[model samples]
Target: MSRRVSDVMTRGSRALPLDATLYDAARIMRDEGIGDVLVTLDGRLCGLVTDRDIVVRGVAERRDARHTPLGEVCSADLVTIGPDDDLDTAARLMREQAVRRLPVVDDEQRPLGIVSLGDLARAGGVDPGVLSGISQAPPNL
Candidate 1:
């Protein structure tokens, strides 16, 4: 059987509340050496924010990072997968959606873990067999 996404997901991923300041969120990401952070609301998955979000949306707009809330800048329309999803499915979803990170959620839509391209790359070879299916199939919604 193919490896499951949960097997590769980074558990206890650093996360932030939607109401948190952009500066706070950025600090967490920088300290963790991670590019993305899951946005939560009362311990439930709401969206995701990335370093690029700060640079492109916050910095470019000249907004005060300390004053701006993460929710305002986060991508609310998130593409996610359940922990039971296969690694291949995660890879295909990432490629089709043009997202580098995928949040793994539980039944209640609570964030359980996160998977990134780096994780996939490091764990598997460049052409990780897990993603071969994605390479063959056309993009599907």
Candidate 2:
């Protein structure tokens, strides 16, 4: 049987507020060694911001980290996964969307956890054929 996404997802993930300062979010990520954080507003999942977002959108833009809010820099139209979804489905979505992380949401759209590419790799459920295909692909080709 295929493993469920929830089985492999990182449960009890930390989240940042949409109105939070970029510097604080970056500090949290650095301290926790997290690549991304879910952006929530009033206890509802609203968007997401990754480490790259801070560099490109905040730093590069010369935006003040102390004043810049997460919502202004986050990707609001986030691609999400359901806890009941299979790992294969999650992987497919990640590949198609070119996103390294996916938020696992409950039926009420409440975030339960997050799944990263590292998690999927560690899960060891990706088919051997798929791994071989990826290996055959050339870098940036």
* Number of residue pairs clashing in candidate 1, backbone atoms closer than 3 angstroms, sequence gap of 3 or more or interchain: 0
Give the Cα error of residue 83 in candidate 2, in Å: 1.1
Model 1 agreement with the true structure over 57-87: per-residue lDDT tens digits: 8999998999999988988888899988877
Please provide, for model 2 over 1-141, each residue's C-alpha lDDT reduced to its tens digit, 9 standing for 90 to 100.
999998899998888888998998899999999877888987889988888889988999999999999988988988899999998988787666666678999887788999877778889988755544444444220
Residue 79 of model 1, lDDT score: 85
Give the local distance difference test score of model 2. Answer: 0.83
Q: Which candidate is the best by TM-score?
A: 2
* Residue 97 shift from truth in candidate 1, angstroms: 0.9
Screening candidate 1 with a backbone cut-off below 3 angstroms (N, C-alpha, C), the clashing residue pairs are none
Model 1 is weakest, by summed lDDT over 10 consecutive residues, at 132-141
Q: C-alpha displacement of 110 in model 2, angstroms?
A: 1.1
